[model samples]
Target: MFSFGLLNLFQLFFLACFCEPAHALAPGSSRVELFKRQNSTVPFEENNGT
Candidate 1:
């Protein structure tokens, strides 16, 4: 019984570690996609002191 409980705790720890990164990466990927679009549309204009 004690070993069963330990196994369950380990499973939850792995699940938490896996899920946290999946959640973090989803937004980062979208941000990179948006940056690509912005760069494509905006020309690299040097701002002469306006």
Candidate 2:
């Protein structure tokens, strides 16, 4: 249970690191585009697939 909570925290951190730049770089961009950009750079998603 403790590890699960830690994993959630890590996910949030990664999300912040990932989304923050998109907002800074293009504040006017649509959310759909930001999501596509995020999906393209999924370091964790690749690992999960393996």
Candidate 3:
């Protein structure tokens, strides 16, 4: 029973982090927004100048 509760607590933490507004998670930190922006940013490709 204790293990189940622990698991639930972790799940709740993830849900809150993913569901809450970016500002709510970190007041003025913009951590969540940074993650969202990272997902949309283009990844750099290896430029092998042959």
Q: Judged by TM-score, which candidate is best?
A: 1
The regions of model 2 sitting more than 4 angstroms off are 27-50
The true-versus-predicted C-alpha distance at residue 31 of model 2, in Å, is 19
**By descending lDDT, how would the candidates be arranged?**
1, 2, 3
Compared with the true structure, what per-residue lDDT tens digits does model 1 show for residues 4-49?
Answer: 9999999999999999868756854866656766889666554597
When summed lDDT is taken over every stretch of 10 residues in candidate 3, the lowest stretch is 21-30
Model 2's alpha-carbon lDDT is 0.76
* Tens-place lDDT digits, model 2, residues 1-50: 99999999999999999998777668546776567767886543433656
**Residue 46, candidate 1: alpha-carbon lDDT:** 47
**Candidate 3: stretches off by over 4 Å:** 21-50
User: lDDT per model, in order?
Assistant: 0.78, 0.76, 0.74
Better of 1 and 3 by lDDT: 1
Tens digits of per-residue lDDT, candidate 3, 1-50, equal 99999999999999888877655667546686567567876764545974
**How well does candidate 3 match the true structure in TM-score terms?**
0.39
